[model samples]
Target: MTTLDLDFVRSHFSAFNEPSLAGWSFFENAGGSYACNQVIDRLTNYYRKTKLQPFHPFPASEQAGREMDAAINNLAAYLNVDEDEIDLGPSTSQNTYVLAQAFLSIMQAGDEVIVTNQDHEANSGAWRRLTDRGIIVREWRVDPETGYLDIAKLDKLLNDKTRLVTFPHCSNIMAHVNPVAEISAKAHAVGAKVVVDGVSYAGHGFPDVDALGADVYLFSLYKTYGPHQGLMVVRKDTREALGSQGHFFNEGLVHKRLVPAGPDHAQVAASSGVTEYFDAVHAHHFGPQADASKRGPDIHDLFQAHEQVLMAPLLEYIRSRNDVRLLGPENPEERAPTISMITNRDGRSVAEDLSKHGIMAAGGHFYSHRLFQGLNLDPEAGALRVSFVHYTSPADIQKLLKAMDAVL
Candidate 1:
């Protein structure tokens, strides 16, 4: 069986070599990943040479536009979606806010949008605000004890008036991977649009949005080892149905329809670096394939295989502790490598304590505060989240475990 080359992977990120980051084992990757060298180089180059308005007639502008176009082209290919379906904006929160307006244009007063307690506030808050416009918002609550969202509950919520069904691909705190394809199918059958917040899951492995059948799939690139931007896949039909949330003249433009916030050209251009990193990884593990959709799934599998290897022992060690309660699945294969534990002490305090031992992690609501309430826990108490990605090494995990033991 092939295993991820950790040394080879870590070399692609310059953060590993930084004197400031030396001796610190990062475990708060769900918050944001350290940008890869590919992305950094692209950003620096863009700022130095082509830091001008894009899509214009001038050379620098043309080059800037080309980089942005290549970014969309490359990323869309990797996500298994068409170029026009991709929308790059400031952040996932802003992107979804604009998208809710699109939905508002299409939705009637009595239409219902299903949300989940497990989603980050970025995905939850905007849609919930639709209540002010008379749109019915339904919540798919998680189990108070386990923080698990049952699909059976969602089945009852799906009906003719269900205009949209919004949920997370995986919770930031819980780390469980929701069945996006299955949920999409159910929503589609009811003539409802599926909006998946893939913010947590995309960091682990970008999904096949085309196959997943989500009308709007949202995730933060910053969390996925790229620039600080939100990437979304808005299906053609959904875009047309909701119409333009941008200027009236831009209604005909596929990319501009929902992106009223416009785009940061440099960051958008840097996105290609993420795809390039994935390409390099794919070619290293398995010979190069021309089709990026093929590369998308292949790279996804490679990432997951490596993550499961890292997650197994960490999960076991957490579950063994009687004092702390682990959220989400008990098995490594069933969830992303984000482990959130509710201990007797405040999670933030635990994180602060871990930091003293050179373990970089976080504790707090993590913008998923609603989840704490749903799980019958106090939001102020928060949950200790120790997350990692492909770039993390076994040595880092060992350091985290030792620090965590000392802190807790």
Candidate 2:
């Protein structure tokens, strides 16, 4: 296993701390991560110095606009795509809602869309809404026992009428990493465009949108150690086909067209901090082997490797406890670091017990209500979620394990 440099990780983020009675363990990285100091500083500085609207003719506004553009460009370059392919929105949920409306204009009433029960409501609900317009919606079911999305099941759902297929790259509740490329190919074979909800997976590491072969991919910046913003990457061809969702004046801008909401300039400027964190990690881990010229996918892979190593022990410890029933795949190879587990006792009760001990784990459906129901776990009786990121420490895992042992 590749080793993560604990000292370097601690140096980068001040949020890494031991469990305290007055504080929380912060195991909810899947929902949102604590913002990095670098991001906070950048945002503060921007607000203090300029406080002007971006893209104006004045020097201050122009410089601010340039900074915002640089941030978007950096993120796009990291994702291995052209700048035009990326659109910045206020939130992932908002982006999905807007994109769904855009699809309505392009797709005919008879067109079919495949949606999975394993996705958060953000991905499933928006597309499913198309049903009201006479669009056919196919359900990509999950295996109740194992919480796995069978590719065979997805195969049966596809046909010539399938115009779009939406699912999570990694489920927020189940944590299973979907076979994106394979699914993308299957959908494309049937003339359907693939849209992936990457909110849970993107924070663990950067994903190459083009390599995933997804026509459109969406994720949240807040969950990835950056600002509160949503990112959507659309293939150039798909963007052209979907048409714009914006006002008549902005119709010419393909990126703005899908996002009817005006861009949040400060939040967009703050997004560059995610790359800043990535750059710092890459330099620390790879040393000279890390090339500044390398794109987002390369740097992200390094962080993924490091995170995988750190998460292995925690997963193993959780598996060892007979009282705990782990959700999703049994092995780390088949899952992300977002581990959701149920105890013999009530999930919330266990979470409360842990809370008394300063463990900041959460217990709920996590908005993947259909997934919990499919797994035969009552959505009302939510499972305890203990998710982590690249910045998570070994000591933090140990603290969680100790809390779990006591609570369970």
Candidate 3:
């Protein structure tokens, strides 16, 4: 098995080399990650030289269109989905809002839609609003003590009337990686379509959308070391089931149907850089002979192995503290690198104190207010979140532990 080359991985991201951010360690990666040099360079070149309307006869326009198309096709290959299924929107929140609207037009008044307490507002709020149109919205609540969504409970939620089921691949606050395939299977048994929010999970590694068995899968590129854009994959059958949200004339185009806000040409084109970065990492560690589809799991395993090692000490420390309540699983294999804790101290104040030691972290509800309320946590003060990615070093984790000791 090939391990991820940390030296080779760190070299792709420009943030590691910045003078101002030199000594300071970043742990707020769940909010957003530093962009890789490949993405930045592509974005700069697109704005400087190819700042023209795409798909035109001119040189700049043709090149711009090619880059954008390549991004969709390349990413689709990595995720093992069709190119037509990929939709790039402004943000994940915006994407779900549009999807909900499409569902609204097609769904009947008695139709049931299920939402979870564990999802970010991006996936929850939109579907919940369908209640206004006489749709029956059911809540798939989480365990207050552990913040885990019990799969057994979902069996009761799904019925003949259930039209859709939306949940997260992993919660931002809880950090427990949900079993998408298992949940999707249960939903499918009841003839319900599944929508998975992968925004929290994608940074670990892009999951195979086909394998996950979700009708609609979403993730944010900004959190995945690219530009601020949301990438959505809607299965062809599901897309055809929903009403088109785009213009009447453009209704025939499946890709443009849901994203009526229109595409950002430069950012979409720059997304190709994300694929390029993954390829570079794969080629450096393993051989360059593997196809894009084959490389996805290899790169995914490499990052997952490295992240689990980093998560163990942090989990052990948090779980041992009498004053703190650690959210999600203690085992690193069962979760991502996002660790949140409820402490006797104020979340904001603890974050401020950590900053003095040059550690970057955050404290807030993270837009999962329903989750906090369900767990009997105060939404006003929220919980302290320390998140990181494969780029984070062991030295950084040591610094975080030391800073946390001083604050607590």
C-alpha local distance difference test of each model: 0.91, 0.84, 0.92
Q: Which stretches of candidate 2 lie over 4 Å from their true place?
A: 17-23, 288-295
Q: What does the lDDT read for residue 172 in candidate 1?
A: 92
Query: If the candidates were sorted by their TM-score against the true structure, best first, what order would they fall in?
Result: 3, 1, 2
Question: Residue-pair clashes per candidate, as listed?
Answer: 0, 1, 0
TM-scores of the models, in the given order? 0.98, 0.95, 0.99
Determine which window of 10 residues in candidate 2 has minimal summed lDDT.
288-297
Q: What is the lDDT of residue 44 in candidate 2?
A: 88
Which regions of candidate 3 fall more than 4 Å away from where they truly are? none
Estimate, for each residue in 290-408, the C-alpha lDDT of model 3 and write its tens digit: 67888988878988899998998998888778998888899999999999888887677789989999999989899999999999989878999999999898889999999999989
How much lDDT does candidate 3 score? 0.92
lDDT of 1 by residue, 1-408 (tens): 668888888889999999999989999899999999999999999999999899899999999999999999999999988898899999999999988988888898999999999989999999999999999999999988878889899999999999999999999989988888999999999999899999999998889889898999999999988999999899888877885878888788787888886789999999999999999988898886999999988889989988888888788888889988998898888899999998999999999999999999888999988999988888998989999998888888888888878987
